[model samples]
Target: MKQRPAVDLSELPTFGHGPRTPTWWGTLAFMALEGMGFAIAAGSYLYLAYLTPQRPLSAPTPNHWPGTIVTLLLLASLVPNHILKRHAEACEMLPVRIGLVVMSLLGIAPLVVRWFEFPALNIYWDTNAYGSMLWVMLGLHTAHLITDVGDTLVLTALMFTRHANSGRRFADVGDNVFYWDFVVVTWIPIYLLIYWMPRLD
Candidate 1:
């Protein structure tokens, strides 16, 4: 004879807001780990720079213009990203679609500027510790930028289809917006580290 334990399970709602869903927890976990990665990379940069008291680890003072432009573009993107987040929260399909298109453009613009940033560093990855750190930091952030942009493009296409009507898709959109904010926030200190630190001499 087998005994079964009975429990009531009928009252839970099938669909809930973004924060109530497992996907939101997954997204938060991902951001926390990624943020830790950025922190470690930044700390490494500081440690290496601290050791070099002479002439900035054999690299010239990098041009600040390209990184500055990218930072500005990233900051500018926050406006539309917040708008997108608000629309997603409201479950407004049309606005979400429009916001996706706008965000896709915003994501692409920074990526284009990011190319110029590498050259403006005035150093190569193989040079020395300073160069290597700068390249690694820039490369790490650039990879995130490309990844999130690709995701935005794909989600933009999805929103134009019948899938846009689904509530989960809207939560996904909110998560994307949340991730983009992280991407932008991480760049500020990195930009300063890569561009302005050498000039302190």
Candidate 2:
């Protein structure tokens, strides 16, 4: 038999280096699209508000207490999520597990509260222009949150299985966290518009 050369694992790159870490370009592109969506929605709301002189049909308007609490929960998730990304980059398992658990809890809590709020508010999609805008905006954001939770879960599993020890894992975690951050940050303006602005006017 002819002798064959042995392959050395050390010779291979620890991680593929072509725009590592979730591809910044891809993340930016997605963010751009999301931003445009939010902008258009906000514009529509403002246009409708301007046309409607009545401004909030009833007094003692919808209480924003629930939304505020949800917002706080979502905002709090950012810290642990960021820490998880950092720990992943350092190839530390403990912090990554802790961070993932925290992030998942943070992401899921707001969604549950949101579901509860919908019924208590006793509003419909066509209740008024405000209702329509509120549903669409919150619905869109909620969709993003659902996706984020799924992504985080996948990452968590990878970490648990020791499949994320590759150099690329850091990039993956970083990328997911970046998108998750965008999802939360984007909600701030929408929250202000939907919950606070109505009360002020």
Candidate 3:
């Protein structure tokens, strides 16, 4: 057989350019919107507090203890979530999975505690202006938390499957972690406003 020169593979064109991937731009835009939403809600809570002559009504004073517990759990979840996000970006699956599971549990446990805690406060959405504001703020956050838990669960499942092998896995996990961090970061000020602040007197 005659000797033949090897063709350079790098010169060949690959299949049509791969499909476009999702970028963090959309996620950043979403976060901006969410930040505005929280700011408006928090402003409303403060405004309502200011408008009332007897703000932070003595009769409907919020209990600090329950809020304290919830705050602790939310604050704690941040650690694992941060770790998992870093790990996911590095394509380290085991730690990401462990962190996701821990983060999910930490995220949900507070809501469960709040379930019992909210009713015990004996304040209804219609009870008073303060009551209404508190409910609206907490309710909005709770909705976010619910969505976060679902997203984390989905990510956890994907981490264990072949789907995670796709190129977009990093983006998916990254976005989820970013959102989770948003939830945790946003809650800090909210906790201060709702839990630590002295009741309107």
Candidate 4:
């Protein structure tokens, strides 16, 4: 058997921030698939609207207030989200922990607002296809929001433990930040679709 040339493995980093690591790519892949789901859902809504232009067979235009509040809150979340991202990238444990706590709270605030959003829709899931689509879109985004919040809370707890010093955990925080941005960005269009689309008619 021929021997391969010697190579040093000691300097290889076990964790990296941002897209340099596998987890970041995995996070991106997840976001891409979820984004596709949103695209398809939005397309279906538009198609239904197109078919019923004269009277969109849907409920009356929903109250835009709650959705508007949630959108503003989501947009506001970006500030802390990016701050957390910066701390995570720098592998700074103190700021990272603080950011995690802030993020956890941020996650919960929108969820609270989300409860009001369903009622603001002024439609029930079983009412008709329009109602069903509306609920489906909201439910899908809420599921993602809940999931990310849960993840953030868990990570926050873990950061308080002895494992806080791990570089991998910082990378995990970075990934969480990345995912939350996706969660927030995806909501903008859905909010418009659910609340504003009916007004255009």
Candidate 5:
């Protein structure tokens, strides 16, 4: 019996970055499901607003400041987020470490600003359909923010330890950046809906 020569497999890298990694695809699929959720919620809000006599149902237009501030912060964070991703891709320990620490803090800043944002709404979630939808949308985004920030914090902590040496860790950092971009980008529409919709004729 002639057995074929077995191919040597040792030359291949154990892991990869971006699409080469399973985690990246999983993150993408997760984002698709989440994006659908956001779309449905946003659609429902529009339907309710269209059916109502008054768009906000007598609630004053929400103060745009807090949400606006959060928006600005999220937008601003992109700079450092990409920087982190870049360093992570290169597996550069120092900048990746610095970026993660900075990201951890940047992540918290919005959550903190978001606290003020809910109050700025000037309407309780239970108040009416508009209020409920607004809160639901905002809450959805807040949940994402919290999730990503927590993940980033954990990764940041891990990056400081001996465990940071692996390419897998840097790949995780890159994925965190990808998810953070989603979180930040999703907020723009939510922001417009929450803050600007009430004022529209």
Candidate 6:
């Protein structure tokens, strides 16, 4: 009589990046929830605009310069972001470290510009519904931007320490890159709704 030998799991990797990881799925769920929130906010803005056919915003058209700058910066960051993802996926420690630092700088740049963006909206949050919605949209994205930047900074710091070599760390970097892309993508429609919608009149 022959008996089947037990399977050995010891040789299998304990962690993985991308879809092979729980972190990846968690990131996807987080993005989906955040996306829903953004959709709801944008829907509200559209509803208000529909109610006011003559002048959707009923406020001065916002200065598009600050937002446009932010848009361009976020778009530009995609280049470095893809580079970082490549390094992370390859588990190339040196380039991942450098990429983290570069990404940290890129993350902060738009936040600094966003300081001016709030004012460039040409209305206060408390002024009225239109202004309130505008701020809500921007505020939502800003919150995400700040959170992701902090995550990047922390990860950058971690990559300089002993833990930098862990395979899980590379996965974390991939997640960070994924979230950063989400932050950038969500802002586009919000930017248009807040700035251009007012000018439609």
TM-score of each: 0.91, 0.85, 0.82, 0.95, 0.97, 0.95
Give the count of colliding residue pairs in each prediction. Answer: 0, 1, 2, 0, 0, 0
Please write out the lDDT profile of model 1 over residues 35-136, one tens digit for every residue: 898899999989887777785766778889988988999999999999999999888999999999999999999888888888888889899888888899
Shift in Å, residue 65, candidate 3: 1.7
Give the clashing pairs for model 4: none
Q: What does candidate 6's lDDT look like per residue over 1-201, in tens digits? A: 999999999999978888999989999999999999999999998998888786645667889999999999999999999999999999999999999999999999999999999999888999989888889999999999999999999999999999886789999999999999999999999988887877765
Give the least accurate 10-residue stretch of model 6, judged by summed lDDT: 52-61
Q: Which is better, 2 or 6, measured by lDDT?
A: 6
**Backbone collision tally, model 6:** 0
Ranking the candidates on lDDT from highest down gives: 5, 6, 4, 1, 2, 3
**Candidate 5 C-alpha lDDT tens digits along 65-95:** 9999999999999999998888988889999
lDDT of 3 at 57: 67
The best candidate by TM-score is: 5
Clashing pairs in 5: none
Better of 1 and 4 by TM-score: 4
Question: Which of the predicted structures, 1 or 3, would earn the higher TM-score when compared with the native?
Answer: 1
Clashing pairs in 2: 21-171
Clashing pairs in 1: none
| CA lDDT of every candidate | 0.88, 0.77, 0.74, 0.90, 0.93, 0.92
User: Residue 57: error of model 1 in Å?
Assistant: 2.1
Give the per-residue lDDT digits (tens) of candidate 2, residues 95-121. Answer: 877788788788889888888655534
lDDT of 4 by residue, 86-142 (tens): 988888889989999988988999899899989888889899999889999999999
